[model samples]
Target: MKIVIAEKPSVGRELAKVFGATTRKDGYIEGKGYSFTWAFGHLLQLAPPQDYGFIGWRKQHLPMLPQKFKLAVRKIKTKDGFVEDPAVRKQLDTIKKLFDEATEIIVATDAGREGELIFRYIYYYLKCKKPFKRLWISSQTDEAIKDGFRNLKPGTDYDTLFNSAHCRSESDWLVGMNATQALSISAGNRTVLSLGRVQTPTLAMICARFLEIKNFVPQTYYQISILLSKDEQVFKAISTANYKEKEEAEKLFVLVEDVASGFPAGGNITAVEAKPRKEPPPLLHDLSSLQQEANKKKGYTADQTLSILQNLYESKLVSYPRTGSRYIGDDIFAGVPDLIAKFTGHPDFGKQAQFLQTVALNKRSVNAKKVTDHHAILPTGEQAYGLSADKQAVYDMVVGRMIEAFHQECLKELTKITIQSGVTFVANGTVIRSAGWRAVFNDPEDDKKDEDNAALPKIAVGEQLPITEKSLLEKQTKPKPMYNEASLLKALETCGKEIEDEELRYAMKDSGLGTPATRASIIETLITREYITREKRNLVPTNKGLAVYEVVKDKKIAQAELTGQWEKRLEEIRSGSSVKDFKSEITEYTKTITHELLIAGASISGKLEEEKKAEKVEQ
Candidate 1:
């Protein structure tokens, strides 16, 4: 008998149905020589500090770094303190029995780092030595699933991936557990201060931005805008001059207006240039990018979008929703046509897919080399019916993105009209020759416009035109905007770098501060710890978050780049680079940071104690 374990019961039931496993038991399904069981996300986790002989919160246990972590069944907090979840334990027992009876095991969990760790930890806890194979499929379509089962890979092929996942879990445990405890102890018993690998840096970013904005003083600047009218065509041109005083800008505006009203009869026609530009459609939706777009358009929070996407994934309306890469593998390309056909009946795709016949599908987002454990998030071509409003909104985003990914690049003519009035004044306009992929989303509001350019009128150079109006516009230099969920996610992915090159961004994707699978949870952790709060669309840090930031603002612990470098080293460790050397390095760095944190905590504690003493003396 073959036993298959999935990450959740919904997915397990879907797979079971496809495999003809009709006999349903209490915790599993069995038929057609297959037994399918599932776990509710995580059935087991590492034991907490109290489980390792540590009692209540004490200053003595400032940095509770366990030597060897122990795995325990999942725990739940009840009126009677924390206890193992009965349902999870029972399901684990059932899985163990199935493992004991089956000759081989098939791991059918989600195809990503956390998913790998979920199954591996359970298998290690069960002490199962039976041969196991991996079922790696990005989509839940029957054909995709059948193909995956037919080509099952050896379990050992993913040892490096599993190692990386394990390292991530352990490192987060070490840093998050110790730092949180040490800080909380120093902060007093009234509050619980939490920290983690991703949450700390994310919190720091928010607090720093808030401080910058709070302390900023706006400065006023003045510019001259000239309105030129020729043949009933009124065009606006901004002066290429900035002045601190309004009087100076006024003088220039008057001078330019005079020059434009009475130009020399035969001023030479300077330059005429028209360039053709092609804007390729955006790559397929990864979870973070999709969430970012949804937040911008629908005002949904990051966590909200994540939950909606998870629902869509469970319904099999879309592929895996947690993938980081925006590229699909070559093996999946052959299935694109069939998937595209499913959209033929979709309201948004019926007309758009018809035009797809003449469009040259782009190959930029189809590199198999860039894909890791999972491909990009896309619709599974399944009919999306009877979905909730939120799910429908998210599903539309996925389907639209998939259709856009395969469509032709948007073609446009960029016209730069240069007119002179004592100085060079320019007006620019973009003429959309073809809508191309943009036709998928027909909403005019959805079009992202470039605000720097002005719409240009068709006029030859050196043509005499009357000056319609002139004005000096006063503008204030704006401070950086507060960190919203989408921008914050982008910043985390880039590790604070503002790289404009696409290839470099792709190269830096792996070393991003946190993996796509965990970035959403990291943001949630900050909110749960009361370090940050959502004010409308912005994520502002709390007073406690600001205090923590003030302490670690200059330290490497608060910098995303430092964390990214460590991630790079961990990757190196997975690829035959000595694990012993890596462990030594991590140990040394951990000890160093631990000592620094202790000194910092002592300083904070001393200040609080001194304040208390002064209050008593005053009384």
Candidate 2:
């Protein structure tokens, strides 16, 4: 019999249903000469240090770099301790049984690096040699599944991908395991100070921002404000230049431009500049972009957004959720009209969708070259019903973005009115001539300043207007705001953009600290480790997090560019580059970082103690 393995039971059942299979067995479905089985995400993981005979956290085994990694059944923490999950072991045995009896095997896991690792780990752990083919599809719809099966590629075609995944797993293990051990041991081994290739760099970003905000000194500045009127319509204007001294601003403020100053029509319109701008619609929603949007619009955390999107994907309302690209290929773009038509009845975006059917689609988001492992998340044109409020919110974001991406550009007229009195004053306003894609959500523009008028009265450059009021305005320069989920995710995506080294920056142009699939987990890990906490919508570093950051802030492990270098090498490995060179480099670097942390971690011992005492007092 031919056997098929999926990453999850729901998927396996779905695949079976599509192929007319209904015979359900203990852990699999059997029919039509095929046995469909599945694993619960990952049934196995890289074994821990103690499993390699590094019995306890000891200095003698400071850098416990195992010669070879071992795979053990995934474990669960109970009251007793961490132990192999019984359910996982049973499923492994079932898979083994199926593999042993199969003629040909089909791999139906998620199509990505981590997905490849999940299946390869299982196959190697089972020691099965049954040749297999890979089923790669972005959408989980029945038609996509059927098409994927009809064009299954040879498993050997993905050997390079598997190689890249394996190297990443081993590299992370070498760095995360050794560095975690070294630091924890050096710091009295009283508490676990976890670190990783990506986790440390991420924590460093939070702590650094926190310190920057903490040390920021506000500079008090002053400016003169005046209110001008044209055709009985009033608008506020500010001096074009800011004054460093209050006395200078006060002098300008008393220069008599107001009606109370006995000067009627004192303000003369120096210049009125009007320019039209066309804003193209935003690109489609990639996972990162979607998460950021959800955070900004609905106050959802990155992890929460990912969870909601995953549910939507599993329901087949959307395509893959973890994709990094925000562009779709021509093949997928061919169906954009029909997909847009399906949403013509959507309550919130119905009018926008109906409007799109009459115009040529904006192909700004269509580029096959930019499409990566999976196209940007898109609706499968599958009708969705009975979704909860949260699901509905996320689903609407997907559907709304589709309409926006394919709609026309928004047309706006920008007006700047310059006034002459004592010193020059200016007022700005924006008028939307055409809503275009902006009509989809009709949300207010985020970049509009509070000082800007919604609309300005029409006036000529040579016209004079009455100055109704004037005052000396006091303002202090504000520090950068704390990293909220939306801003933080964007920062993470473009972290390498600031690197001084051209090669390093270019290497990381496409890759950031973590992949789209792993970034949510990385944020969750920091919170779980007590390195950061959610303060309202912002992620603030905790005392414990600050303490850890202080120790490793200057280390290579804490640098985001270091991850970029590794990502470049990993990409090279995916393109048939030598893995041995990268592995050797990682081994050496692990030894170096492990030694550095062993010494540097001692400084944080007292800080950790203070945190413990503070926790006790709070409790």
Candidate 3:
């Protein structure tokens, strides 16, 4: 008999149904040469510091670096202390029994790094030696599942992926456990000050920005806008003025509009340039991008979107929810037509579905070279039914994104007209010739430009156009905004550079501060530790968070780029381009950071104590 183990019971049941494993048991399903079992997310995890014989919070254990981390059954919080999770242990026992009886094992966990770690930790903890094959399917469609079984790869082929995943888990544990304990102890705070590979830098970003904003003194700047009119056509032109005083801006506005009739003209409508631009449809939804769009449109937090997407994935309405790539693989391209056809009768797709049938779908998003462990998140083509309102919203996003990915590019004409007053003025406008793929998701708000750009209208070069109104606009130089969940995720993806280079961003994408699968959880960790709180959508640092940030602000420990570099090295290790020098480097870095933290000048707890004493004296 062959035993298959999945990450969760929901996934296990789905696979079991397709495989005809109908006989249900306590912890597994059995029928016809197959036994399907499931784990409750994680059956085993790395043992904590105390489990390694390191007693209570002490200075000697400041930088507790384990030579070889130990794995044990998952633990749960009891009234007295953490105890072994009974449900996990029982399921493990059942899995072990099945492993003992079966000739071979199949790992059917989620198709990503964390998923890989989850199963490997269990197999190692249980000391199971049976040879195993990997079931690597993205969506759990019956056809996809059947195809996966026929082409099962040897388990050893994924050793590099497992290595990367293991390294991630261990590194996060080392940094988070050591840094958190060291900071908490040094500060003498009774409350636990938590930090992690992703959360620490993220918290630092919010606090740093908050400080900058708080300390900033707003300065007024002025610019002049000219209203031009000719032949009943009206257009507005802006004066490029950098005036420290309002009087100077008024003088320039007067000179341009009144003193010299429309100012001395250097040129007027020298050329009218209009070119057709095609904006290809957006690729399918990846988890981060989906979270961002949802946050922007529906005001759902990143964590909320992740939860909703997870539910959608479990319900078999979408593909895997934690993918980084927005591209599908070549193998999955053949399934696209049928999938698109499933939406034909839906109100959202009734008109657009016919367009898909007539035009050849773009295959730019389907590249095997770009696909990692999992393809993009897409609808499973199953009829979505009986979904909660939140789930329905997310489902629509996925379906709409999928339909858009295959549709034709959006065509638009960009017109740039330059006008002359005393100073040169510019205006820009875009005429949409065809909405094309944008028709799939009818979002009118998407047409709005970024805040930096001013709206303009269509006018030919040298064509006399009337300005509707002229005014001197006063604006203040704005400080950076606080990191909302969406913006923070974008910052992480770019390693905090705010880069505009596509290739650089792409190179840095995989090395992002946190894996796509774990970023939402990292934000939650910050909130749980009281390091940060949400004021509406913006993440604001708490006192503890700010204190920690102040201490680490100048250190590599608080820089997202440093972590990105480390991630690059780990990737090199996976590809055999670099030796695994990570352990030694991590050991040395942990020691340095912990020592510095212990002796750092800031005394947050002492300050608190002094404040309390002063308050008592006043009373």
Candidate 4:
């Protein structure tokens, strides 16, 4: 019998039902030629220092590099001490028994990086040598499962992927474990001040932004605005340049008012530029994009958004939640209309689904070369009725974007009007030519914009009109807004380079700070370590967090670019690059960073260290 191991019992049960594995047992289900079992995420992990005979924290054991990293069953911290979880152990035993008896194994874990780690760790930990095949599927739909079985790949085909995942785990263990120990020890050892390959740079982003905000000095400025009227329509335009003083602005404001009052034909409309603009529908969402959108629109935190999306995916209501690709391949695109059809009569999205049927599919989001791991998140065409309010919100976003992607462009007429009245006061307006795909969702006008989107009256070059009103407006230069979840995710997605265009940002995502699956956890780790706090929608660094940042700000770990480079290396490793070379680089860097962090921790928290020594001396 073939042993089919799934990532979770729920998924296992579904697969079991599909394969006729109806006989339920202690930790798995059994049927004809297949024994389906499940693992509760990761069953094993890299053993901690004490497990390797490094009994306690001491300076001499600073960089505890292991020659052969050992895998032990995952331990949970209890009141007595760290103990193996009984549930996890029982499941592992059942899996071991099934594997021992099986002629072959079928790996039915989540089809992603972390999922690979989960199964590989179990296989290696249990020391199973059976020939195995990987059953990779994007969704829990029965049809998808059937297709995956018919196309199972050699488990060896994913050996490169497993090596990549293993390297990531070991690299994190080496860097995070050593650096965290070194820094925590030097900083008076008061608390477990934590750091990680991804979390530290993330902390640095928050602290840097916070410091920028804390030190910003606002400057006052003034602008001259004149309200002009032509053909019974009035609109406002501001001075081309902001004046340093109100007196200068006032002087300009007077001249503009006089010039406008004298002119009959709209104050010499030197230039009236009108051009049609089309906004192609937004591409499907990757996890980060989804989280950013949810944060911006629904005020959900990054962690909250991931949790919701994950729940939706596990419920088989959506595709893989941890996808990084925002584009689907031609194969997936061929069936999109059919998937959208599932939402027909969906109560909320029924009309949208029906409308999308008539519109030609926008091939903008279809690119086979761009898709990796899994395609962008999409509804599984499963019933989405009865989702809680939050889940429904995310589900709606996925369904809406899919429908929108198949529609026409959102065309608008952009008009720029420049009036020369000793100074060029410019006015701009956008008139929607056709809502198109935007109509699939809510009104696009709901988004706030700095420019006045009021209708611009028809005017031509050389035409002049009298000014209706003129005034000097007082304004202050505003500092960069605090890093809200959305903006911060955007920053992280682009490695601190602020890019507004979706395609460019998506291109930069692979080289960003962390993987889509791990970024949410990184943010939460910062909060858990008390390194950052959520101030409303903003991620603010706590005092302890700031101090940690101060110590390591000059270090390599605090730089986002460093993390980006590491991300690139991980990708290289995933694509058949040598894991040994990557591990070697991480080991050397670990030594340097461990030393740097030790010195930094001592220098920054020297007073605390002295106090700690004094207390010890007294004792």
TM-score of each: 0.92, 0.96, 0.92, 0.95
Q: Model 4: per-residue lDDT, tens digit, 312-419?
A: 877778888899899999999889989888888876668878887887778889999999889998888887668899999988888887888777888888888988
For model 4, the run of ten residues with the poorest summed lDDT: 257-266
- lDDT, model 1: 0.77
Q: What order do you get sorting by lDDT, best first? A: 2, 4, 3, 1
Collision count for each candidate, in order: 0, 0, 11, 7
| TM-score ranking of the models | 2, 4, 3, 1
Better of 2 and 3 by TM-score: 2
Best by TM-score: 2
lDDT of 4 at 473: 83
Measured by lDDT, the strongest candidate is 2
Model 2 TM-score (2 dp)? 0.96
For model 2, the stretches where C-alpha displacement exceeds 4 angstroms are 496-509
Model 1 residue runs over 4 Å out of place are 54-64, 258-272, 443-455, 500-503, 570-578, 602-619
- Tens-digit per-residue lDDT, 1-619, candidate 3: 8999999998888899998889999999999799999998878888899988888887788799887899988899999898998999899999989999988899999877777788899888889887799998877778788989999989887777788778777888888888878877887756566777677777777788889989999899988776655555555656655678998877776655432354323335545666788887777777888998888878898899999998887777889889888788777889898889888887887679777988899886888777766788989888788998899988888888888889988887777666665566666666678888888877453655432133344455565443456677898888888788888888888777787543456567767887677788888888988878999988888766776787778766788878877777666666654335777787787887788777762466765456557768989
TM-score of 3: 0.92
Say which prediction, candidate 1 or candidate 3, comes out ahead on lDDT.
3
What are the per-residue Cα lDDT tens digits for candidate 2 across 481-598? 8988877777777662544332343235456778778889999999999899999999999999999999999988999877767877887788899988998999998989998999
* Candidate with the larger TM-score of 1 and 2: 2
TM-score of 4: 0.95
